[model samples]
Target: MTATTADSVLTARAVLLDMDGTLVNSDAVVERCWRRWADRHGLDFDEVIKVVHGRQGYASMAVLLPERPMAENYAENREMLAAETADMEGVVPIPGAPAFMAALAGLRLPHALVTSADVPLSTGRMAAAGLGLPDVRVTAESVGASKPDPEGFLKGAAELGFDPADCLVFEDSEAGILAGRAAGMRVVGVGARAAALGPTVHVDDLTGVRIADAGGGEFRLTFG
Candidate 1:
């Protein structure tokens, strides 16, 4: 997203944030963990990652390792992946995320984090990424389905005390964008070249977005 793309036009009552690429730079951890899993299971690495990124563990495992009994693969892979990621370093905050989240707090705008990660991983990684917790957060455990299904974002909107239509979501992946739209919310595309998917607005990072109190129950957000 350009520096002056739509700073003047973007505003919302509530914001829904996707966790991984949107809020934090966990791509290194993800790539390393998944690559190891692929090697162990004799599966295709790139294909496995595409199916799994921003998705539930069991679901991704089922899609990538279809020949095994899912229950077994899910349990084992979850343990292995978690172990590998537990001591992860170099987990950095996404550009602009800290400022964006802090601005939300200053405006007191209702917001929630909606993530495909399980509870343990989500909390751990968010801390590692140096992000403050949101007022409401929906993890993979809270939903029956994953991103591209609308369940995660729908649950997040409810938890944050807003209708889906009253909220705007920020996401980096195509699946995350699809989920936000399915939930009837406008989406802001994040990350490298994610704008090609057509988010309501795009910004390079959270640092480029700001919020101000618009008074009388409304908040204003600007993209720069």
Candidate 2:
């Protein structure tokens, strides 16, 4: 991984993006749901929130409740997914996300959404955020393991027909950044949460980014 600097240029043949904190600001809903879960289990929401981002609900549960049975986590995760999908309150796109997506469309770069969110949850959240879904997606159901395992990002790169080294990832959470690195892709950390995670580059938001076609199946990302 490269140092996290505001000014940098990265070239890649494909792009993989994380949702939630990266493209969408769903923290309000995330905190609300996780707070309830934390309370129910007599855990601290503060610590739980730190582990919840960039991972599937069951994965987060496993980390928070290491001694709990996997079966129990899976069951609760299902319920949590349904509840989160049904609730769209406070879901909104990150600043400049709309323009960023539009820019990608204009450039026609190969890109995919590689998110820990299941199909329904991802779909609902993106809709609530008013962002168009990328044609290729690697959702929670698409892989056996979650973020920090590199499964989803690797799958996304494969589906896009690009090698991991040829892809660039945009992520916000520590788990997502680690997964991108594990997949051998350069990462552009998206928010304040991502600053200390050692992404190839860090930006305050999409507003600080500029994407341009660099010809020959490659795209250039300029961060400021």
Candidate 3:
């Protein structure tokens, strides 16, 4: 949780990215769907949204409806995923996401998408945001536990053929920042929500991050 200065530089062999609030700004669609869910469940929409950002649908439901059956949560999660995937009206990339992704691709960097979104939902949302998918992806279906558990980031690092300590995670939620740390990786917190959470570095958006080859299969991430 070392905060960054304009001169800060982090070197890593691989990068792991979170989707929703990190790379894609899908808050509009998330609000629409979750608000409806909250109404149906007779819960507070404000409270529900607070817990929904970094978790999978079932995980979020379980938090909001602790007494609800796990079977019911899974069932409803399927429906929620469908609704989110089908509605991409307000989905857009976070600032500098397009260029950041392009820079990674152009540099042939080792990177993976580690998101709470399942395959279809991730695909649709990234498409809507006009962003390219990384070759390695650890989606909801790929992990048994959600963020704050560290499984996704660990798997992402393994798939990228790097040790967790050699990888850097870019995320925008408390759950995500915790997960990255638990995985023994450095994390770059993105967006306003992440500013309050302690990450290895904090940035308003991807625009504040500049990555350049550091030689020997590593890259240097300069942050402000």
Query: Please, what is the whole-model Cα lDDT of each candidate in the order they appear?
Result: 0.79, 0.92, 0.92
**Which portions of model 2 miss their true places by more than 4 Å?**
1-7
Off by over 4 Å in 1: 1-8
lDDT of 2: 0.92
Task: Write candidate 2's Cα lDDT for 41-69 as tens digits.
Answer: 99989999999999999999999999999
Clashing residue pairs in candidate 2 (N, C-alpha, C atoms within 3 angstroms)? none
Q: Which residue pairs come into collision in candidate 1?
A: 96-206, 96-207
Q: Give per-residue CA lDDT, model 3, range 95-146, as digits (tens).
A: 9999999989988889999999999999999999999999999999999999
lDDT of 1 by residue, 1-224 (tens): 11234344555678888988899888888888778878988888987777776666677787776787977866975785576458567788998778777777876889998998777877888889878988688987789887888998888878777777778888998888988899998888887746788888877787877677777766667776
lDDT of model 3 at position 197 = 93
